[model samples]
Target: MNQAVGVVLLSHSEELASGAAELVAQIGAVNVPVAVAGGDAKGGLGTSYHRIQEALEAADRGVGLVVPPDLGSAVLMTRTVLEDHPHHDAVIVDAPFVEGAIAAAVAAAGGADLATVLASAEKARSVRKF
Candidate 1:
């Protein structure tokens, strides 16, 4: 069986996660799991790490962790989680906030590899009309 490739979005609010989830859902790839880790400060990174851990474990093959732009402390929080759980099979990707989620969804549906997914994301970002 093909292992599942999941997406994890770390944001300042649950709404950001939900928006990403909605985009992925719209793309119609139900096989890959999509999760969101928001506002880690409230419950501490431990809570967020646990949440991310479960998502990563379920992913089996690997996961792409997305971060928003200008997210100062959240980056630290996520890094701590990554360091504490090196055994977890996942890769961290620095994704542009808007394009990242859309790219993730499109890639997941297209069954593209992580590098391809990331490339696609960059392309999408670069091709802005504005």
Candidate 2:
């Protein structure tokens, strides 16, 4: 069986991350593994390296992992976590938080591989409304 790619959503607000995950599930990616890492240990609006690390571990299920951060600091924290955990099969995508997570999750639900899922998330950058 093909392993579905996993997604990790990072945001400064726990509600934002969890809400995005829920939206992704509602959008038909319920089977895909999506982990959320948002807010600090004290439940403040900030990213936590430890929380991100835990989310990464939880999201990765033999398949590769995709990380999309909601803010610049969250992105930096995710990068730091990945740097520390060099063996993780993961990539950090530069894309909008909600759109990227939903796109990646949809691709993953279709059993797309790591690269494809990452591409899907990055592709969200070109999404425009005219």
Candidate 3:
């Protein structure tokens, strides 16, 4: 069976990242590979290359990975980690962190492929909040 796409939430705060992941679960994104990459090695508020790498490994299932970074620093860290993994099927999408994570997680849970999942995440950038 084809594996579902994975979604990673990269944030500066561990609590924020985990809370977002929990929200995805509450939204019925069951069985999807959702990983949280947040905080530094000391468990404080900061992005870490190591944490991002760990999240990538845990989420990836040979299908693809969609990471939505919560801030600029997280984005940079994710990018640096991804650079080392040249052959990995992954992408750092420029989208709203929570909204994109929920969208991507739902799509992945529905067994969508990489392209579809990627598009779904980016589409969250247009999500209406009004």
Candidate 4:
């Protein structure tokens, strides 16, 4: 069976990451794995390297992993995890957090490949609100 691409949402606020995961679940009826790593163990407004690592490990299902970070530190932490853990198929997308998560989830739900899922997240950069 083909596993759907996994998604990891990183944010400084636990609410933001969890909310985005909920939104992604609501947007599609697919069984893609959606994980959230937000804030530190103390539940403060900052990225947690440990939390991000845990999320990545939990979300990865041998298919692939896509991460959308909410802030600069979140991105940095994600990068550090990727480098240290060395999940070659995993990618940290440079796109709007919420939008990218939504897009990536939809694509993953459709059984899109890792590259396609990453592209879907990156495509969110072009979305314009008028």
- Scored by CA lDDT, what does every candidate get? 0.59, 0.89, 0.89, 0.90
- Per-residue lDDT tens digits of candidate 2, residues 54-116? 999988888899989988888788888889986368888899999999999999999898889
Q: Write the per-residue lDDT of candidate 3 for residues 1-130, one digit (tens) a residue.
A: 5688989889999999999999998998878888999899899999888888999999989899999999888877787888896527898988899998988998998889988999999999998999
What C-alpha lDDT, on a 0 to 100 scale, does residue 83 get in candidate 4?
A: 87
Residue 95 lDDT in model 1?
A: 57
Model 3 segments beyond 4 Å from truth?
none
lDDT of 1 by residue, 1-130 (tens): 4544566666666566667777777778576667666544464432365655554454445545333321555566666767877635455555576577677657766777666666665566566657
> Candidate 4, residue 22: CA error in Å?
0.6
Instruction: Rank the candidate models, highest lDDT first.
Output: 4, 2, 3, 1
- TM-score between model 3 and native: 0.94
Error of 2 at 6 (Å): 0.6
Local lDDT at 98 for model 2: 93
Off by over 4 Å in 4: none
